[model samples]
Target chain A: MKAIVHVGLKPGVLDPQGKAVADTLGRLGFDEVGSARIGKVIELDLTGDLDAAAAEARVREMCETLLANTVIESYRIELQA
Target chain B: MKAIVHVGLKPGVLDPQGKAVADTLGRLGFDEVGSARIGKVIELDLTGDLDAAAAEARVREMCETLLANTVIESYRIELQA
Candidate 1:
């Protein structure tokens, strides 16, 4: 089985990296660009011993404990077998 | 409009970051974890001037030229209104 965790900053948080990227895009002539917010994608491959529910639960726990800083970021989980 | 670009390492490419993360997870007691690949998610907000197709093309170009290292990475683009 495989799981993908997509992590993003909360809406109100300031993202300097995104701001830099947006500014660079404008300098590069993409004038229509308004803003950019950078995040992370964590892909995990696991043994098939666990069922879908268990896999999702474990992955979610991983996100909560290690993959994300819940105070300023949010994450979504997608599981594939 | 909004666009999300997900950049990931190509298959067979070495990912030291992923290896480190997987090892950390194992140390933290998530022993069932097999492999972990870390990637980036870039979210762009643009003016509604461009149509969906055009927006996608522009974002794809951005990924190819700036956001991702196409030599060893692959990117996927998603456009949302």
Candidate 2:
């Protein structure tokens, strides 16, 4: 099974990197670009015998514990066989 | 309008950050984790008046020209109103 996690800054969080990119885009003539927020995608390939629900639970735990900074970030999970 | 871009390493590309994360997860007891590939998601908020198709095309161009490294990275664009 595979699990894909999208981790992003929480609303109202300051994103320096996003701001930098946005400014760059504006300078590069993409004036239509108002804001650019950057995030992370972690694609995990799982092995061993774990059911879908079990894997999801474990992955969510992992996200909470390490993969995402819960205080400042939010994550979405998608699973595939 | 908003455009979400998912940028990822093309298959066969080496990802040291992903490898490190995978190793760390294994040490932290996620034995089921076989591989972890890390990527980037860029969320762009568009302010100017661009129709859906035009915005997508412009975003795609931005991806190819600046957002993604065409040699090793592939990007997917999703537009939202």
Candidate 3:
């Protein structure tokens, strides 16, 4: 199975990277562009016999414990075969 | 409309960040983790009357031109409303 994790600054939080992308887009004549927010995606190729729910729980724990800063960020997880 | 862009190192590319995450997970006892690849996801709450297909085309162009390094990275785009 494969798991994809996405982490990003929470709504209402300041995102310098996203701002930079937006700024660059504006300068490049993409006048229609209003905002851009950047986040991280981690694709994991799992092994062994970990079941789906267990894998999700473990992955969520990983996110809350290490992969993301919950204070100022939010994360989403997706699983695929 | 909203646009979500997922950018990641190509299959053959080296990802130091992903490796770091994997190392940390291993140390934390996620022995089931075999490999981790890190990437980026950008979510934009777009404005204007940009049609879905047109927005996607523009986004693809943006990815090709600046948002991603095609030589070493791959990108996927999604549209949500």
Model 1 chain B: weakest 10-residue lDDT segment is B57-66
Writing each residue's lDDT as its tens digit, candidate 2 over B1-81 gives 999999999999999999998999999999999999999999999998899999999999889878999899999999999
Superpose all Cα atoms of candidate 3 onto the true structure and report the RMSD in Å to 1 decimal: 1.3
Candidate 3 TM-score, true structure as reference: 0.93
Q: All candidates' lDDT scores?
A: 0.92, 0.95, 0.88
Per-candidate TM-scores read: 0.95, 0.97, 0.93
What value does the lDDT take at residue A41 in candidate 1?
90
Q: Give the per-residue lDDT of model 1 (tens digit) for A1-81.
A: 999999999999999999999999989988878999999999998875999899999999999989999999999999988
lDDT top scorer = 2
Chain A (alone) TM-scores for all candidate structures? 0.96, 0.96, 0.93
DockQ class, candidate 3 = medium
Ranking 1 against 3 by TM-score, winner: 1
Question: Each predicted complex: what DockQ?
Answer: 0.82, 0.88, 0.80
Score candidate 1 by DockQ.
0.82
> Which RMSD does model 2 reach against the true structure?
0.9
lDDT (10s digit) by residue, model 3, range A1-81: 888988888889999988999888779877667899998888877888878999899899988989999999998999887
- DockQ agreement of candidate 3 with the native complex: 0.80
Best DockQ goes to which candidate?
2
